[model samples]
Target chain A: MSAERLLWYTAVMAGVTYLIRVLPLVLFRREIKSPFVKSFLYYIPYAVLGAMTIPAVFSATRSLVSACVGLAVAVIMAWHRKGLLPVAIAACAAVFVTEWLMRML
Target chain B: MNAAERRQAFKTGFFDGLPIGLGYISVSFTFGMMAVEKGMPAWAAILISFTNLTSAGQFAGLDVIAASGSMIEMALVQLVINLRYALMSLSWSQRLGPEFNLIKRMIIAYADTDEVFAVSSARAVGGKRLRFIYMVGLMIMPVIGWTGGTVIGALASAILPDAVRSALGLAIYGMFIAIIVPPARDHRSVAVVVLSAVAASCLFHFAPVLKRLSTGFVIIICGIGASALGAWLFPVPEPDCKPPDLEERSAHEC
Candidate 1:
């Protein structure tokens, strides 16, 4: 992509994200009232993360098996409520080891 | 706040943000490598991190840019993926100190990321209003970590071994799992919502007709659909007591 186009897209993303973050802080000082809206907002992050992780995660590494192993390690560490850094490092280590073993075999 | 007090607040916020900054280094390092691997120039990848300061949204946005998706698609993808910031902003706005004017609010909003929001919210939870200097103090380290790490990652991508580079591709997804899994484990509603999203995403990925849709659309559809369903099926119950106003909340804590 051209530098101009990349910058344009980046600006669009930054603009929308900024609008989302800033508008509420400036204008919506009142507490939100609706239960359903609150619930929906509460779940959006999880849902988005979930959707983004799957299928893509399974292909993130050099091989599907290694990726699957990485995912398993990540899920286990995360289930234990490990910090993001630890979980990420463990997952990467798992994939690295799995792929090494596969190469040796 | 007095000048001395402002300096102290900035120092405290800086230390508080240090750990989050440390964490961002690792995640954004992976982001930098992935962005370059996807054919972005080192500078351009770093530019995205500097400007966006969001993990998922930047990664998703990178995908759209790489795929040459429409501007509309990029905008919609970011709007959906980063919508949580809006909710966090709204929740935290009520806790802002009287001195937080329009300009300060706008500046703080730029750094209203998930980790930053978490730490700031905790500071405000006892009814103490958030301070402008403290918030700025809290954000500076993480911003440096995020941008600096990306610069290193983008530059190092060329020198890193292929095996190492490929393995690191899983890092962002690992971070994503770290974000969602604990919440899902604790809350059945969250678990249901996450699983439903994964299922929907798989359908879009593997289903012949649906697979034709771009990744940006897939994320938007699956995210909105699953979260909306979760809300319908498991609406968060209202607080038992009347939620106290900001002053009342502080008074009760005191």
Candidate 2:
């Protein structure tokens, strides 16, 4: 793509993104009426997180295995309500160790 | 919320964003590396990371750059990948003080990353004001980490060993886990998480129809469809509380 085209594309996407993000705030104001919409909205984060993570973690790729281990440990830590830092550290350690172990095995 | 309490919301939002910043170092590093690999300038990669504060959009944008797509294509890609932020921003604005004018709205909108949105949303439900302090509350460390990562990624592409770089790449996926699994314990949310992912994977892998579609198009279809369906399936009960605001009326109530 031409430089001009790329910049234009970026600008337009930025606008759409900003608009989409800001519009509901502008339009809805305080009225998120449908309990269904509210409930569904709650799940968007999970849905995005899950769909994004799983494929990365379990696919037939090396990093994926480490990612799974790190994630599993992180979940356990968070479920127990550990601080975010420890969970993140332990999970990252899990990935590093898993990768190292795979190399040894 | 009083002065002290409003201050506490900033603390909550800030710390909530803290741990995740660690994971960003590696991911943004790779993103910067990849962006440069695709001929995006070092400064451009860093700028994108700093401004967008998103993983999915940057990744898709990188692909768009790789494809040498038209400017329209690039923007559409960003729009599709980032559509979720709209929902997040909407949920947050309601929690803002009525005094919040255009400027405050603009600041919060710029800082609305996934972690910020998540933490701010939680506090907002309690009807506490976090968005005002919310930008300063959550964004400083992350902005530093992301920008730093990109700088290193761009400069270190040749020096970093492939195996080590590849290993570190796993950190991004790990970060996603930190973001996802803890929240999935709730059943209604869990089902949404599982199905949406399964659907994204299946649609991408099996649906020859989608193969021709751009990354931007695919994400929009998946995100909108999954979110809409999940909403249809399990709705949250409306809170039965007096006055949506969470600040105690009496000075002693807090």
**Number of the top-ranking candidate, with DockQ as the measure:** 1
Native interface contacts kept by each candidate, as a fraction: 0.79, 0.43
- For model 2, residues A9-50, the per-residue Cα lDDT tens digits are 456645766676666665656656667666556555556555
Query: lDDT tens string, model 2, B12-105?
Result: 5577667556557777888889988888777778767776777778888778777877767776667766777786776565567776777667
Highest TM-score among the candidates is held by which one? 2
Clashing pairs in 2: A9-B71, A21-B86, A39-B236, A51-B197
**Residues B198-222, candidate 1, lDDT per residue (tens digit)?**
9999999999999987675687688
Relative to the unseen true structure, what is the C-alpha lDDT of residue B253 in candidate 1, on a scale of 0 to 100?
24
lDDT string, candidate 1, A4-48, tens digits: 998999899999999999999899766566887766755666786
Q: After superposition, which runs of candidate 1 have C-alpha atoms over 4 Å from their true positions?
A: A1-13, B1-45, B54-104, B112-146, B153-156, B240-254
| DockQ, all models | 0.50, 0.44
